[model samples]
Target: MMLSGVVSAFEKVLIPVAGRISSNRYLLAMRDSFSTILPFMIVGSFFGIIEWVVIDPTGTVMGPNGMGLGMKMTGLTGEAYLASAFVATLKSLQALCNLVVTIGFGVLSLFLVAAFSYRLGGIWGGDKFSTALTGIGAFLIVTPQQVNKVGGFSLDYFGNKGVLAALLVATVSSWVFVKLTKNKKIRIHMPDTVPPAVAQSFAVLVPVLFTLGGFALFAALLTWFDIPPLNDLIYKVIQAPLMGFSQGMGFSLLYQFIIWLFWWFGIHGHNVTAAIQNTVYMPAQLANQDGTASYIFSNGFFEAGLMHIMGLVIAVFLFSKKESWRAVAKLGAPAMLFNIQEPLAFGLPIVLNPILLVPYILAPLANTFVGWLAVSSGLVPIFRFVVPWTMPLFFCGTIGTGSIMGGLLQVVWLAMDVFIYAPFVIAANRIDDEINEE
Candidate 1:
């Protein structure tokens, strides 16, 4: 009864807070914007694995001895015509892969600006096209055009470094556009006979122009003061620090705890936390992909390493004396293999169930610590690929890290998690028996 009271109190406070955070317009815009580019990011990382790790003779997989697949198969060494041609072919393929990655991950912030404004426009009832253009213009206006002797709009502000600035510019630009269009006095009302497409374009023109011009003036002021571009400033002052803190074990542990805590109260913890996770950890994932930095924890870590629900299913199936628990495990086992735990979460009644709460939360945290240790100790490579949430257990880790050691690490974590849940399942059987006798 006391446990139930405590659960009710926590639920009262947390459900409302999580709901508000999850439903916030700006955060939704940020989440959807990042989501819009996720497929492209995955495509880039897939080819990046091929370009940097799979084929290159100097890569970790191929070794520094120049004995690549083609060389080994053809029984040829340096300077031979066939070997030289193969090497040239490999280089060409690498260049092509690099092109794909460049167009995708290379201009991530550019996509974010357009996507964020488009989503925000929908939320604000603005014309999506015009609002997106204004957002992009605002971003470009506040971004540096020259970098490292590159004259045209620099690539420096188009990648992960410009992510936060892109979101900021998109929000401000979309707000201005929405507000201006709503003002009847300033709106360019077209004739009733005019086509809707043409009329809509003309109607949004003033809003787009003024919003972009405002950013242009802001950019000019920064230049006059000899200040760095807004992208650089935000990266230095905000994004970098947040990214650093997110990579720490303390932050990962707290985040894991909060996620399960929300889950225990029947909230979709992952969706509720998506906004902050995408905003902070995603940049570190990009940096790791680019090999500019090493961050052991990333968005991929959750899907690949820390989702230990399958472990509980196994423990229940193998060790639980309770028939109800085994039945839920049987039904939930297949879905859990694919990393979906909703069936078990509700069926096993993980929500508000005092017996299961400790293991439900503790398993993921334990997996996180072990996963972090494995990656940091160089036993498993840092996660670079963004594995789909539906990716199966062992393969998720392997594909995410682009190494077999990652799969082994997942197995290790799974075994540990199973043990964690086993004892709890036995305890639950005892409690059930006691209730029956009473």
Candidate 2:
């Protein structure tokens, strides 16, 4: 009775807490903002593939570490591979693609600023478009504008470096703009004869000025401290420590613990844990792009691609006698290719079922271990690309890691998980058979 009471109270506390976090506005805005631009990021990945295989065959993707997937594909040998990969025809194509990636990822902060500004701005009854634009202006005001040695204007500040600044600016600026504009005393009131668009633009002009002025002051304070740019300040002070916490085998164990614990209790674990992802893993991925090499477990690593395929293999070969498992196997096969497991999780009914927990939890950890080992041992390239969450199994692995070995390792892990799940599958099948016979 005491144990039952404890369990009851635990559920009472956990459920509401999870629900509240899952519905949090800032977290939702960050998630939706990412979701909005994820497609363009994926398009950028295609260009990254070209750059990896065609423009620069010298890197980890197809260099000695990757066993030369690009070299084999193009049938180019020695200096020929390096020389021809960037020949004029391919050079132009690569240049165009790189520009797209720069626009996609290099100015990722801009997209995020626009997206979250629009999202948070709607709450204050603001004009979403104007508020979003003003958020960009405020972000630019705060960032340091630099000129390169070649006399070219540079704004690397608008790229991954500024993600944290962009998030805060977008939310604060848009909210502030809305508050100031909605006040009758401050807002410009045009006569009824004026067109709505022109009047709305003029109405926002005062609010935009105030928002930019506030940011300019914020920038000055940072400069007073001799701080590097705002992005560097954010990276050193906030993102760096959070990212440090996200590293190591222990972090993976802890993250897996949270993800599964919530998932077992019927909460969407990732949705609630979105804040950690935005703060830690997302920065880790961007840092990976900026030449940092040690980040083996970013969002890309946690997003396992073929774990579902392994489940299907276990269901088919081992659980043939269990009609329910087989039914779920067929239904889950498609979603599995896309890395979604909800159908199997609910339909196979793994949640809260003691019989299935061992395999359910173990499969992902097994996959993670195998993948981490492969990357750490240099048998596969560390995944540096932004993998779209819903991309299919092999494609996700290849595109994400920029190596054929990465895709093959996913297949290897898929097979390993099937073997791991085999005993539990057999046990479940036997129980089903016994029940049917009875």
Among the numbered candidates, top lDDT falls to: 1
Tens-digit lDDT string for candidate 2 (1-438): 343343345446655765675577766666567667666665665576566554555543455445576577678767787677444445666678788878767777788899889887776688989988899888877777676666532556666556667777887898889999887887888898999999998898888888889989888988898877676666666555666667788777677767776565444466445556666887677777667665888877776443544564465656566777788878877766656566676677665555555566777777877788898999988778776566666666776787888788877877777776766667666656666789
**Candidate 1 structure quality by residue, lDDT tens digits, 38-129:** 67766776677678666665453453343366667556655572446666777888899999888776798898899989999989998887
The whole-model C-alpha lDDT of candidate 2 against the native structure comes to: 0.70
Worst 10 residues of 2 by lDDT: 1-10
Per-model TM-score, in order, reads 0.66, 0.65
Question: lDDT of all predictions, in order shown?
Answer: 0.76, 0.70
RMSD of each: 7.0, 7.3
Per-residue lDDT value at 218 in model 2: 84
Cα error of candidate 1 at position 286, Å: 13
Single out the weakest 10-residue window by summed lDDT for candidate 1: 58-67
Query: What is the model-wide C-alpha lDDT for candidate 1?
Result: 0.76
